[model samples]
Target: MDPIVEVVALILGFVGWVMVGVALPNRYWKVSTVDGSVITTSTIYENLWMSCATDSTGVHNCREFPSLLALNGYIQASRALMIAAILLGTFGLVGSLVGIKCSKAGGENYILKGRIAGTAGVLFILQGLCTMVSVSWYAFNITQDFFDPFYPGTKYEIGEGLYIGWCSSVLAIAGGVCLACSCKAGTKEKYPLRYHDRGTAYSGAAPSRSAAASTYERNAYV
Candidate 1:
């Protein structure tokens, strides 16, 4: 694997995992008025596991939501997917680090290192898919709620966390692709001459009578 490609993938995957972790605990919405102005008197933010409200005076309080079993289907699914992505990303990061050619953990076996790197790339791709699905589903729900005309509940706008989640997912997917590409066959040149052919060439022998007759026939035809 090219060292540059390996390094680039490692960096992107690490940063994406960090971003996802940061976004997971953040609130996905901001309580706002119908006029689109933020309600500073009481600001609310929410995540998969909890919701928090901050007062105008900077005082903040958070409360955990109901158990996972009681949560809505989308919420439950998103939570599960995000958590799974995080775990997979963690393992992928470790595997990538060990498998990179710049690292000595996987030893001097180039083929084994390539396999490990390819596996890690697959893991990263899976993580990215999980995160993308979770974020997109949650964002869809938010958009639906925001546009619903019949709902009398407080109007909410998309929060920063969701944007971060989208970016992180994209990065993870791109990194995985780069890492996978690095597992392709290298450009190193192969031996041009076969061993047996080299031996035959080295062991010179006199031409047979059949070869001389064939040469004479070819000359006569020409």
Candidate 2:
């Protein structure tokens, strides 16, 4: 496997993992849209974990969501998926560290290392998919509510958290694809090391001048 490719893939995966962690605790997954309000005393925002509001004076008030079961369906799913994504990223990070060609952890067995790297790539892809689904589903709900005229509930716009999640997902998937392609690295090789057969060209090359000249004498027949 190419060391450079392994390094690049590892970097992307690590960055993507960090981005997921950042996006998860972010408080602005959704912010109340102020388009129709004539008087806005405060703006409300929320993430999977909590709700917050900032007054016109810039003072902020925040509270955690009291009950997990009471939250909206998309919110719950998003929370679960994001958590799962983080976990996947964690495992992927470990795998990449052990599998990379430049790393000394997995020894000199390149084929095994390549397989591990490919597995890491799969995990990264899974992490990206989870993040992508969570963000997109949340955004879809926001848009659905925003466009509905009769919807009495507070309408919110997609916030920075969602964008961050999307970006993270893209990076993770891209890195995964590159890494996954490396699984084929040692597949075409018939053997890890070549063997010299007795009658092959290698045999001719192995004999020294004296060895080639020497001949075994057969015993005289009775």
Give the best candidate by lDDT: 2
State TM-scores per candidate.
Answer: 0.81, 0.84
Per-residue error (Å), model 2, residue 89: 0.4
Please give the lDDT score at residue 205 for candidate 1: 38
For model 2, the local distance difference test gives 0.90
lDDT of each: 0.83, 0.90
Off-target runs (Cα >4 Å) in candidate 2 are: 189-222
Local lDDT at 47 for model 2: 93
Clashing pairs in 2: none
Clash total of candidate 2 = 0
lDDT of 2 by residue, 107-208 (tens): 999878888999999999999999999999999999999999999989999999999999999999988877887655545453444443434666676686
Clashes found in each candidate (C-alpha, N, C closer than 3 A)? 1, 0
Taking the tens digit of each residue's C-alpha lDDT, what string does model 1 give over 189-210?
Answer: 2234466567666554335556
Which RMSD values do the candidates have, in order? 5.0, 5.3
